[model samples]
Target: MPWLISCSAGYQKATNTSLATTFSNAVERFQRSYAFPGITASYVLPDGTSHSAAAGWADVENGQPMTSESRMLAASIGKTFVAATMVSLAQERAIDLDAPLSTWLGQNNWFQRLPNHRSLTIRQLLSHTSGLPNHVYLPAFVETVSERWPEPGNPFTPETLVRFVLDAEALFPPGEQWAYTDTGYILIGLVIEAITGRTYYEEVNDRFLEPLGLNATSASNKRRLSGLAAGYAAADNPFDFPVKTTDENGVMFWNPALEWTGGGLISTSRDLAKWGAAIFGGQGVSEEILNTMLQSVPIGDDMPGTYYGLGISIFRSGPLSPVFGHGGWIPGYSSSLRHYAESGITIAFQVNSDRISHQSLSEIELCLARVVISSGEKTDCVP
Candidate 1:
C-alpha cells in the first residue's frame, strides 16, 4: 500500500521557443500559489511551434520533481480521441452518426434492455444527449471499484460496465434533454469493437497514436506505467481511494482500463498538446467529419454559452476569444486541452492532483497564454 518514491526530473524542451522561461516561471508560480504537488504544461502556437515545462514534485512524499515527459491519465480529454475516431469511422461509411443503436446492437439480447437504447443515436451519445445515466457514478459500481481496487485484472469490460445502467430509468427521453454520461462512450467503444472487429485501443492506435508519432501516449490498460507520476487525491473521495493513487514507483493499485472508451489514454503534456493542435487544425479527422462534429448543442443554464459538439466542448464564456476543447478528471488526476480560435494556439495543462479547482487551473492557463499574447504584441500582432 506504500507508494514508491520516484526520482527527481525536470522540464526538457527545445531551446528554440523563447517562452520556455516564461512558461516555466508561470507554472511554478501557480503550482506554488495553489500548493499543487506537481504540474506540467505545453502549448502549440498557430504555426505548430511547441514548447513544454514542469514544476513541483511528481511524487511529493519522496520529492520526485515533475518533468515534461511525465504521464497522467487524461480523463475525459481522451474522449476526444474516441470522438474523432468515431467521426472518422462515420466518414468512411463504416457507421452512421445518426444511426440508432438498433443498427449495430439490435440483435444483442441486452440491447433492448438499455434505457433509451431503442432511440439512441451515435450523435446523441457523443453529444451527451442520450439521457443515459453515468455508470461511473452508480453507487454499486463505485462501491465495487473502491472495495476491490488493487485486485489484479480489470474486471469491468465494456460489456460488464454496461450492467450498471441496465434497466435503469432514463434521465429523460432520448434527445429531449441533455445530460453527461460515460456509459454512452462505453457503449460507443463496444460499437467500435463490433463494427471494426478490433479492440477499441487498437483502432485508436492505428488512427492517431502511431501516425502522430505520439510515443508517450498509450491506452492506459495496466496499473503501472513508466514516467507516470504519483497522483494525489482526497482520502474521502467518492472513489474511496487513498491520498496517493500511485506508489512511488508510479504503479497504480488497479487497472484504469476500466475507463475504456469512457476516457482511457495516459499521456504527457507534449503529446496532448500535439494532439490538440492536430484536432483543431483540421488534421485530426476528415474535414467533412470534423465539420459534423462542430454542430454543437447547448448544455442548458448552469454552463451558459458553453456547448457540447461530439466529444469536444465549445466555450464562449469569457473574453479570451472562442475556445474549443475538453477537460478530463478521475481520482488523483486532472487535465485540460483547449484551442484558442482567434489566436490559433492550442495549450494542454495537467496536474498530479485532482484537488485543485478549475478556476485556479484556468488562472494558471490564462497567465501562460498572456505570455504568448504579449510576445506577439512585440511583432505588432496578437497570437
Candidate 2:
C-alpha cells in the first residue's frame, strides 16, 4: 500500500551514534510538519551504528506515545518474507522456481479461471509479471469488505480472494507486462501451503523469524495486538475504515486476516531494519541467488525510478537511488525499508496515518537518507 519505499546492499554492523540524533530530529520534524499523529524510524549505518526514533501519539485519544517499538501493519512488505522463503526453497532445489502454476495449483478446477492462469509460472508471480489483476481493488471485493464490517470473525480466505479475480480478463499475457498485485503473492502463499504441507506463516516463522530472533514480527491475523499503534485513515476512503482505526483500549476494528499472505505482518521500525539488514545484507540468501533477485526490470512511473526483481524493489534514481528494499501500505499505515547500496546503510520508517501524499512520503524518505549518509552535515527531511 506504500506509494514509496527503501533495502539492499553489502553487510555492515552499525552501532548507535549521531545518526540516531539526526534521525530522531528529522522524524520529529516531519511528524509535526505533516501533522501526522505518529511516526517511527530506524536505521543501521555502515559505521556499526543502528538507531530508532519516534514522535507524536500512537493513540491520540488514549494519550499513548508512539515509540520506536510500536508495531504497525507492514502491508506488502510481507511479500518479501514469502518471496525469501520461496527463493530459499528454490535455491535448495526444494521448489522449482520456473515451474508453471499448474505444477501445484492445477488440481483446483478453478485454476484456469484466474487471469493468465493457464501459463503463469512461479517466477512471474514472484516478480509480479503474472499479469494477474489484483482482487483487492475489485469493486465487488471492496464492497464486500465494507459490507462485512468488523473484519474479525468475518475473514476473507486467500482462495476466496483469488476467486474474485476468477473469470476476469487478463491484464496482459503472463510475463508480458508488470503490475503489482496482492493476488499473486496470495497465490504464492497458497503454493507454499501446498508444497510444504504447512501454513505460509509457519514456514516463514521457522525459517526466518525464530532463528533471526525477530521477536517483534508476527502475522497480522488478530484483532488485538500488544503495543500496536492506532492508525488513521481518511473519513471517506475507499476501504470504509474509520478516521481513527483503533479503539480506546488499542484494539483494532478490522480483521487483520483479510490481508493474509499479501502483506499481513505487523512489526516495529527496529525489527524492520534488522530484517532488512540481515536479508539484503547477504545473510538471508546466497549471493548467487541474491544476484538473480537483483535482476530487476523497470516498474514504470507508478514507482518512478524503481524496478522489480523477485520480491525486492530497487530504487535506482533520485537521492535514494541504487538502494534495495520494499515499501508497504495498508488502510492506515505506510512503511519504507531500504539498504543503501552505495554506503551500506539500512533504514526503515513507519507512519500510523495513511493520509499523507506520495510527494510527502518521498520527501520524508529523502530527508532520512540525507540525515544518515551526509556525515553529520546539517540537513532537513522536508523538501
Candidate 3:
C-alpha cells in the first residue's frame, strides 16, 4: 500500500579506472536538486575495488547525521527481498515457479469468480503479472480495519495481507496484463508462511538478514530504529500541515499487512547494498533461479519502461543505460536499488520525503548514470 524508501552507497573500481571526480560531482548535484534530508551511496565494481559515501541527516528533527549504518524504510524496495526469499524457496524445492497457487491455497471455488485465477503461478506473482488489483484500494476496509491496527511499535502479520487480497477481485487473467499489485507480493508472504509455519519476518531474518549480518535493519515496526530518520509526506493540507506523521494517513501506516511482500522491510544503505551484492553474486540461490528472478517479462504497451521480472522491475532505459532492480515508496519514503549486471556495479537511492516525484528522481538518476559511464575506464582507450 505504501512504498519503502532506501539508498545504497557505491564503492567499486574498474580494472583500469578513474571516476572519482565524476562520482563526486553526481552526488553533489543530487544533494542540491532534492535538498534530501539524507543520502547514503555505495558502488562496487567488477574488479573488487569500491567506494562508499554518506551525506545528510538520519534524523531531521533531532539533527542526526546520516551514516552507513543509519536504517531507513525501504518502502517497496522490499519486494526484492520478497523475491529473494521465493528464489531461495525455489532452490530448496519448496515452491515451483510454474505451479499454480491453488495448490497451496486450495479450492478453485473461492476464486472461481475470476477466470484463470486458479491457474496463476507463483512466478506470475513475483513479476506482478497475475493481474490482481491492489487490495488496499478498498477505502472502507482501510479506514476501519487499518485504523484499529497498531503503530510502528507493532507490525501487522502477512496473513492479514493475504486475506485482503483473497477478498479482492482479480484485475485480469493470469499473465494477461500488468499492474504493479501489492497483492502479488502479499500472496508471496502467504506462500512462505504456508510452507514454513513461521512468520514472514522470521523467514526473512533466518534465511537472509541474519546470514548477511544486517543487524540494523528489519521490517521496522516503528520503535525508533537506532538511527532511522522519520519519513515525511507532502502533507494532505500543506498550509495546515507541511508534513504529517505517516500514521495519520492510513495508507501511510507502517502496517506490514498493508504492504507485505510488496513493501514492508526497513533497511540501512549499508545493509541494502550488502543484500544487493548477495543477490547479484548468487550467494543464496542457484544460478537458474536467480536468472528467473532477473529475466524480464512483458508488461504490454501501456506501461512504458515497466517490465516485471521475478521480484524486481526491469526498467529499460528510454535514453539512458539499462538498469535492473525495483523502486519503492511509502508515505515518507521513496527509494530504488539498481545495478548494471554487465558492469557489476550497483546504485541505491532513498529519500525520506515523497514530495519528490519519480520523474525528478529519474532525471537525477540519469545525470548520475552519465557520470558513471563517462568517467569509468573506457574500453576503447588503449592502456
CA lDDT for candidate 3: 0.64
* Root mean square deviation (Cα) for candidate 1: 6.2
CA lDDT of every candidate: 0.82, 0.82, 0.64
**Per-residue alpha-carbon lDDT of candidate 3 for residues 1-383, written as tens digits (9 for 90 to 100):** 02222223243444333575455445544655568777766555545445555677656766667666656678788888888887787778756788878777665344444335668888888887888776656565466454554444343454554555565666787877777777778778877777778888898889888987867668755443445566776766222223633432223334433555677777765566667766776775668877878777767787677677887777675644367777777666777777766556666767777778767667555544544544443312110
| Candidate 2 accuracy as TM-score | 0.93
lDDT of 1 by residue, 1-383 (tens): 01111111222333445566666666776677678889999988877778898998889888788999889999998899999888888888666788788888788888888998888999999999999999999999999888877678988878889989999999999988789999999988887888899998899999999998888999888897778889988778987788888765668977888898889989998999999899789877767877888889999988898999999899888746578888999888999888888878788989989987777666555656665545422211111
lDDT computed for candidate 2:
0.82
| Per-residue error (Å), model 3, residue 280 | 2.2
How does residue 377 of candidate 2 score in lDDT? 51
Per-residue lDDT tens digits of candidate 2, residues 139-179?
A: 99999888886745746988888898999988889877789
